[model samples]
Structures are given as C-alpha cells and as structure tokens.
Target: MRKLTDFISESFIWSVGITRPKPGQERLAALYITATLAASILAAMTMFLLVLHRL
Candidate 1:
C-alpha cells in the first residue's frame, strides 16, 4: 500500500515534467496535482453547461 502511493506520486510528478521534490515535499506535490485536476474538471463542466444552454 505504501509503495503504491509513492509510485503514484512519483509518476504524477514525472508526468508533470517538474523536478523531483524532496522526500518531505511529496505530499505537497500530490496536493498540488489534485488541486490542478480538480480545477480542470470544474472548468470543463462549467463550459459544457454553458454550451448546452445555447441549444
């Protein structure tokens, strides 16, 4: 379980093309990724609703 979380966070950081954070900073990196994903999803939903209302 622990290793899985580490791998996921590391993969996220790598995919984002950012430098590997220090050991203590992994949590913050994960939080930043989560916030970014959430914001993108929210923006897409808002845009979809606006377009749907035009019909």
Candidate 2:
C-alpha cells in the first residue's frame, strides 16, 4: 500500500511538469522557428531575384 501511494504521488508530479510548457521554452521555440522561417524566405527571394536578373 505504501509503495502504491508513492508511485501514484510520483506519477502525478511527473505528469504535471510534463504536460505544461515552461514560458522560456515556449519563447525560445517560437524565436527559433521564426528565425528559421525568415532565413528560408530571404534565401528564396534572393534566389528568385538572381534567376530573374540572369534571364
């Protein structure tokens, strides 16, 4: 019975932490994704302009 109770308590704490995203983690992820997308778009536009100039 004691072991079962301990197991349940540990599981609850683990689930709570795992289920929520920390604010800093969310912000970091957003910044990383935004930067990657912006870089990709800039590269694509540069390539397009270069191709147009060649033709």
Candidate 3:
C-alpha cells in the first residue's frame, strides 16, 4: 500500500514537473501538495453544495 502511494505521488510530481525536494524539504513539500489538494476539493464541494441549494 505504501509503495503504491509512493509511486502514485512520484508520478504525479514528475508529471507536473515539480523538482525533487531536498531531504530537509520533504515534509514541507508533502504538506504543500496535501494542502493544495484539500483546498481544491473543498472548493469544488462548496460550489457543488451552493448550486444544489439554489435548485
């Protein structure tokens, strides 16, 4: 499971052209990616709910 997740993350970063982070920056990079994903999902869900409420 862990290896699969690592492979997926590596492929995503590679596809996005995000450079490999230094050893000290791994946590920060991970947090940034996670926060970005979370914020985008939250924004999409909020828009979805607002549209449904209007209808």
Best by TM-score: 3
lDDT of 3 at 48: 100
Q: What is the lDDT of candidate 2?
A: 0.58
Off by over 4 Å in 1: 1-11, 14-17
lDDT of 1 at 46: 94
- lDDT at 41, model 1: 91
Q: Per-residue alpha-carbon lDDT of model 2 for 19-48, expressed as tens digits?
A: 433655644444544456568899999999
The digit string of per-residue lDDT tens for model 3 on 1-55 reads 4454455557669889888878887666666666677688999999999999999
Summing lDDT over every window of 10 consecutive residues in candidate 3, give the lowest-scoring window.
1-10
Indicate the TM-score of model 1: 0.63
**What is the lDDT, from 0 to 100, of the residue 17 in candidate 3?**
88
Ranking by TM-score: 3, 1, 2
**lDDT per residue as tens, model 1, 1-55:** 4555566667777787778877798777666666677688999999999999986
Q: What ranges in model 3 sit over 4 Å off?
A: 1-11
- How many Å off is the CA of 3 in candidate 2? 46
The 0-to-1 C-alpha lDDT of every candidate, in the order given, reads 0.75, 0.58, 0.73
